[model samples]
Target: PRVTAFSKQLEKFHVIIDSELAVKMLRDAPSPGKNWSAFLKVDCGNNRAGVWWKDEAGVDLAVLLQNSPNIDFAGVYVHCGNSYHTSSSEEVIQVLDDTIERLMTFVNHVRQRGVTCSTVGIGSTPTCRKPTDRMKSLTELHPGNYAFLDVQQWSLGSCTEEDIACCVATRVIGHYPRRNQMLIDCGFTGLTKQGYGEMASGYGVIRGHPNLKLCKMTQEIGFVESLEGKLDYSLFPVNSLLYILPWHSCATAAMHSVYYVVEGDTVVEEWRPTRGW
Candidate 1:
C-alpha cells in the first residue's frame, strides 16, 4: 500500500525486499511503466529483517527479481547490526569479517544462477567506522549513525567520546541535599528512556562531570546525584545548564524538532530536520 501511495516519489529511491511477497507487491504496485529499483535484503547474522544468506530460497528470490520485467534488481543489502553487541573492536571486526564472507558466498551463489548483483553492501556504524581491507570488495557502505555518534557507538569502539557530535542540554531545576540528589528540567519526554542500566552514569552520561550520575528520570524531570561522595549543590546552581551525552543519539534527536549546532560556546546555526515517514 505504501509503494502504491508513494509510487511517483519512490521512482527516485531504491527499496529493500526480502521475500517473494515483497517482490510481488512492487510488481503489482499501481505504477504502470515504472520499473521499480530494489535491493535484496540479505540476513548475514543480524536476524532482524531479511532472507537468510545461506537459504536457497534467497538465491531463488534473487533470480526471480533479476528475471522480472517490472522490477530492477539493484543489488544485495546487509545490515551488520550484530557488530554493535561486541565487547571490543577485535570482536566487531570478527563479526564484520564473518558477515562479509557470508554475504560474498551468497552473492557468488546468485552469480552462479546467472544473476549479476552490481552493488553488494554491508552497513553498521561499528564495522564502517573501522574499515577493513576486505570491505574494498563491496561497492557501497551506509553508516547512518556515524553522523551523530552516541555513547553506544563509543562503547562499541566505533568512535571516541570526542567524536560524539550531539547532546541534550538541560538546566538544573531543584536541589535536595538530604537525599543527595538534584533535579534537571529534562526527562524521558525530552531525552528519552532508552539507556537505562546500560551506562554507569545511568540513563545518560553527564558531560564534563565524571562524579555526577543521572540516576533517574520522570516525565519532565531527571534526578541526578554524585556517583561517589555527597552531592554539591553549589557546583550546580539553579538555572545552570547541564549537557547529557545520550546513549542513543538517534532516539534523543527524535525528541526535538530543531537542532542547535554549536561551535565552542556559540550557537552558530539551527537545523530543523524533516519529520515523519
Candidate 2:
C-alpha cells in the first residue's frame, strides 16, 4: 500500500481514524514500521468527517485505537467547519468554544482510560481568526484559507476587505444602456461563481465599484448591474479593466492553471500550479 510504502521512508505520520471500521482497517493493514501514529478525529458538531464526540461507539473506537500496539494514538483532531456559517463574532466564539469543549471533554474521557494524547488540534479559518480566548487548550491551529482571504471570509466577519490578498482582473467587454447592464470578460472560468451565503450579492464584488453587482454569468461573460443609482456607462467604458474579489478564493484559483503574482503594477512572477488531482 502507498501508506505502508511511505511509512518505510518517512520519520513519522499520524493517521486519522474517525470510525470503528477505520480502526479495524488500519489494524488489519500491516505496518512496515512504528513511525506512524493515529489521530482520533472527533466530530465536535461539524457533522462532516469524524466520530461524534457524544457517541459511545466513537469513544469506544478511540479507546480501541489507543490500546492498539502497532499504531500509537497521538491525540484528537476536530475541524470546526460550522464556524464558517457564523454571522457574528458571538456566533464564531460560541462555535469555537462549543467545539473545543466537546473535543476536550472527549479527550478527558480518553485520557482517563490511560491514553497519552500528545496533540490536541482544532482549526477552521473563521474560528481561528476570531478565537477570542479558546486557544488555551488547543496544541495546534490549522487555518488553511488564512493565506488568501476572500470575500466569504469578509462576509463571515472573519476578516476585512483589506485582508483579502487576491482578486481577479476582468475587462469590460460589452455595454447595454437600454437594459442598464454591462458585461465583463471574466465569468465562472476566471472568477468562480461561488457565492457567500446571505452576505454576498452575486458572483463576486467588483473591487472599488461598490454599486456594480455581478448579478449573472455564463461561461465567459458576467452581467453587472448597478445596485443603487443608474450605471454610468462612461465610467466603465468597454475595454476598461476591473478587479473582482471572488467569493471563494480556493474555487477561483482552482479554475486557473497559473497565478500571475503581482506587486503593485509590476508582474513580479509567474507561479505555476501542479497538474491533476
Candidate 3:
C-alpha cells in the first residue's frame, strides 16, 4: 500500500523506491512533474540480495537512479537477513555491527558523488536489538516481525523466551513401551520444520518438559527422546496434550490452515488463516 500510495502520488510529491526494478521503472517513467528518490540496494556482508557493497561501482547504481529527471537518489539500503541464521547473540551482534559499518562507508561514498541525498536505511530482527542511535543517522530502520518474535529471535538476544507469542498443541497418541518414546499425532504435517541447525536436536522445542525432546517425526508419527538417561513412564501418559514451542513460530504456524485458541483446557475459538506475500 505504501508503494501504491507513492505510485498514485508519482505525479505530485516526492517519494522513495526500495527495489532496483522500482528504481528503473521510476527512472524511465514519463515526466511525473516532481522528483522521486530511489536508492541502490547493496549487500555488504549479506549475500542474499542487493548490489555487492564491496563492488567499486556499488554506489554507481545510485548514480543511475539519480540520472533520471523524475528520480532522485535517496541512498543505498541492505538487510542482514542472514544474521538470523546464527546461534549466539554475540555472533548476531558481530554481523549486524560489521554490516552497518560497511553500509555507512558506502553511504559516504554516495555523498562523495556530489549528489544531494535524502535518506539511507537497512534492517533485521537481530540487528534491531542493537542500539538504533548508531544508525539513526540512516534515513529509516525498516525491521518488521520484531512484534511477532520466535525462538530463533529469543536465542539471538533480539528477545526473551517470554516474547514468543505463538505455540502448538498436540496430543500424545501412543506411549512407547521403550519408556520415553511417544507416537504423537503431530508431525511435519502439523508443525513444519524451520529450526536453525544450531539446535542440538529436533525442529521444535518441548514447552514444559525440560528433559523430554522431540527426537524425530514421520508423516504422522513423532518420537520423543529423553534428554538424558532413560525415559520414565510415570510422568507422561497417552492422550496427555503437549504444547510444543516452535523454533520459528511464524513459519510453523503458516503450515496450519487455522489455529485453535485454547484457554485452560478447552478451545473456545479458532483464529483466522493468513496468506503469504
Whose lDDT is greatest here?
A: 1
For model 1, what is the alpha-carbon lDDT of residue 41?
96
For every model shown, what is its TM-score relative to the native structure?
A: 0.95, 0.88, 0.74
The C-alpha RMSD in Å for every predicted model, in order, reads: 1.6, 2.5, 4.7
What is the descending TM-score order?
1, 2, 3
Counted clashes in each candidate structure: 0, 0, 0
lDDT of 1 at 130: 81
lDDT (0 to 1) per candidate: 0.90, 0.85, 0.72
Ranking by lDDT: 1, 2, 3
Worst 10 residues of 1 by lDDT: 3-12
Error of 2 at 132 (Å): 3.1
RMSD (CA, Å), candidate 1 to true, equals 1.6
What's model 2's lDDT at 275? Answer: 65
Q: lDDT per residue, candidate 3, 149-186, as tens digits?
A: 77777777788776676777888888777565777778
Candidate 1 structure quality by residue, lDDT tens digits, 1-277: 5555566665455789998998988777776447778899999999999999999999999999998777889999999999988899999999889999999999999999999899999889899988888998799998878889999998887888989998999999999998999999999988899988999899998999989999999999999999999988899999999999999998999999999999999999999999866
Candidate 1 ranges beyond 4 A from true positions: none
Candidate 1 Cα deviation (angstroms), residue 226: 0.7
Model 1 clash pairs?
none
Q: So what's the TM-score on candidate 2? A: 0.88
